[model samples]
Target chain A: MSDSPIVNEFNQGPISCHAFNGDRTELAICFNTNVVTIFRKSGASWTQTSTLVEHDKPVTSIDWAPKSNRIVTCSQDRNAYVWTLDGASHQWKPTLVLLRINRAATFVRWSPEEDKFAVASGSRCISVCYFEEDNDWWVGKHIKKPIRSTVLSIDWHPNNVLLAAGCADMKARVFSAFIKGIDKKPAPSPWGEKLPFNTLCGEFSNGAGGWIHGVAFSPSGESLVFTGHDSTITVVSPGTGDIQSIRAPYLPYLSVIWLNENQIVAAGHDCAPHLFERKGQQWAFSASLDAAVKKADVGFTARDTFRRMDSRAQSTTSTDTEVHTHHQNTINSIRSFSGTPEHVEQFSTSAIDGKLILWNADSISRGLGNLHL
Target chain B: MAFRKIDIDALEEDAFGEDEIDFQEIGELRPVADVDAQVNSRAQEVRSLLQRGNTSGALSTSLQNPPYGAPFHAAKARNTQTVMEVLNSIKVSDVPQLVKSLSPEEQDVLMKYLYAGMAAPEQNNSGHLLAWHEKLTEVAGQGCIVRVITDRRTV
Candidate 1:
């Protein structure tokens, strides 16, 4: 395994969304466009295998379920399609999901069990879509009470019944996405005992009230951490009503995922992913995962400097456009590329620069010296 | 086919219906208090602390319970003036020491006051307020400024 971060410069437009298959061989990415392109990993490089072209507008989010080998892509065209590989033709087939929403579908995620998926939309509601065997197509059930604004991001509880949504209204909420026929009566969790659909389990504001950009459940689902546009990461424990908010120094984060029970990785406008860890009882900023080395002032000897000063009438080179960090732009999405929820060995981050970087958590732990993941 | 841009405000009105009252507007509505007695007394207390040369105490006292949720604009203005006076009186070199002495929550409150003071530059000394802003952010990190911006309650 490579200790250094593997940077794949796809050079497609900004990758708005991406997902990896079970063994991390194939990748599904949408380049802020209408089509979803699949790439088969070949050594250090990737070659495009096929494209899923169903959505009329830009695909906003994509989730590839590992166990089921099904890829779900949601788009601003207000539709979601589940793509399955066909054995006979060696091609992928798309099954359209009836979202029943008039506005753009912003985000989508398959539950841990891969039985149902939740699609967050600009219609101020969440559509919990599940496969209906009798109808032979996926159907959606709307969860639409008390959500005042567009739902930005949603995460599934480990139990697959409770859904946590971060909204544009600056509220992070927990609601029951429990479907009668599709879901089994979930075991009692801190959220609630009742298994009814659209039950408002909990509602929270990140103290100062910035739009919640990203939300994620802890490995155990006992706690939820959300990043807000106010540059604050707030952790909520519904069982204890314990909420801890940390204001980060960097620009607001757009996406966050738990590396393990105690460690969380979040990235956004700062163009670097930061690690936040739960120390003792409080969660605090640990370190930046991007160990960006300052660019050395190379080839600027005294003679060269004098020659350049005489010619250009400038003391320093002002045209160096490269940012020292690996990802040249905002990293919008981060996911566990390998390992279990309890211990994510490696994780991947995709940025607006159209570069996908796979980072080794173990190497980061070693690099930090004192921080042990 | 030519597509027309959807008016999000109109779309929201259609989805939720025009009769629905905005909860935020309702939250802002409250019975106006007639007297500015509490605000006046607090400002007086802060002024006395400043007169005693207890700059930290004056700073803390001024930050405590800034007037809000009322139509007491004059009282709020008076309190802001008093707070600005306390801030301006502090020595620039002594800022880091004063900031270090403040608790985490107190530091956040100071940041809010710093931002509030900077808003009215003509009344408050921008140089002094900017120095305090530097010290506050140094101790509280940028999150304090964010907290102040996001917090609906104002000084």
Candidate 2:
């Protein structure tokens, strides 16, 4: 339980986004560029497998659908491509999606059922795209109403009908992405009854209006939680419209993932993941995944102090430029590394500093418990 | 036959299309200011106006306040076109002077706002955003803005 996480630092600069294969053995990462490189994991190390280059601009997001073995990537080029592997040649093929967005696509996510996916764009709308047999390619249906600004992130419900979108409009909205051709009639849920295409179930914002950065559905799909640029995380239980927003003491979070029904892990500009727990009717922040280690000040001496004073003439004592955390820079994404969304045993976080760190859930909950985290 | 009736309520094919406005052109929707009596709150009031896409309204409000009133927030919106509009309508130094008068803490928050505006390296908005930031930092003094970002405890 005390063992360190597996650290993989790439010298290839920042990773714009990354996704893992169904087996968790291969990784698809964009090196802050248009290219997506796939890496195969061998033991504790990783090896490059393939590079998919189709977009003419930087890729903003990536999602790997496990069941279908398909990789979907959206880029600032106002385009998205679905990559499929050719079994005979072992080459990845790109299929363009007709998003029809005039601006950059900001984020994307695959539906729980993996039959379709949603791409959020700076065009003030979301494009729900899926395969069309008649057209022999993927087609998109736009949901443009009520979104006055860019959407920063999106998540699909377990039922595969409702979608939660966090947009720059300072609101988190739940809209039904029920395509007439790709989906069947969805059953009634807490979100709403008689779900149709483009149905906005509910919209929410924090006490202080802030741009929403991250959103996710609880494992039970009964509640939704989102983080905003104002350094706050809000939870909404649509059943009773119970909203609890926590103004975090730390910096803003860029993304969030439900660890289970009761717990969530969020990370962003703070560069470290923080845990939140729900008990009964109350939601509260519980612990830091990377607990701050107190460094003893035993090495300071008069000679060093005088040397420092003579060098810069400043009284600043600390010289360490890095935060005492696993990630040295802003962590942009946190994805499930092992286990299903219902019960994640481990997860991975990638940062702008080009480092990937994987954490074991059991150890985190156990290790931090002793520290009263 | 020439005056056939039509279903006037039918939805247009491109009703929700984004050709009218690009996403980058949208204004930052920060919280509107409450009608507080304090001068700092009044500064925030001008800012709220910009957040709501009321550039002219912000200028008028700042004018009514007189003396120290400056459209500090309207400049911070960083929409480029909006800021340029306000600048062209007044002295370019007016907003910079107001930003310059902001306390060290206020400058840090303003820098954070600018940093967020430069989000997404691929968005290619850093050049414009950085230009404003450089001017503001110059007024705020060297290393003051960065000290806030690097050490949250400082502010």
Clashes of each: 0, 0
lDDT of 1 by residue, A118-229 (tens): 9999999999999999999999999988897899999999998999999987789999999887789998988889869999999988766677989999989999999998
**Among all candidates shown, the one with the greatest TM-score:** 1
User: Which stretches of candidate 1 lie above 4 Å from their native place?
Assistant: A299-323, A366-373, B1-35, B68-72, B103-105, B148-151
Fnat (0 to 1) per candidate: 0.40, 0.00
Per lDDT, the best of the predicted structures is 1
Residue pairs of candidate 2 with colliding backbone atoms = none
lDDT of 2 at B3: 82
Off by over 4 Å in 2: A1-3, A294-317, A368-373, B1-155
Could you give candidate 2's per-residue lDDT for residues A196-271 as a string of tens digits? 8888999887644457889999888999999887677899998887999875656788889988877889999878
Q: Each model's TM-score, in the order given?
A: 0.89, 0.70
Location of the lowest summed lDDT over 10 successive residues in candidate 2 chain A: A364-373
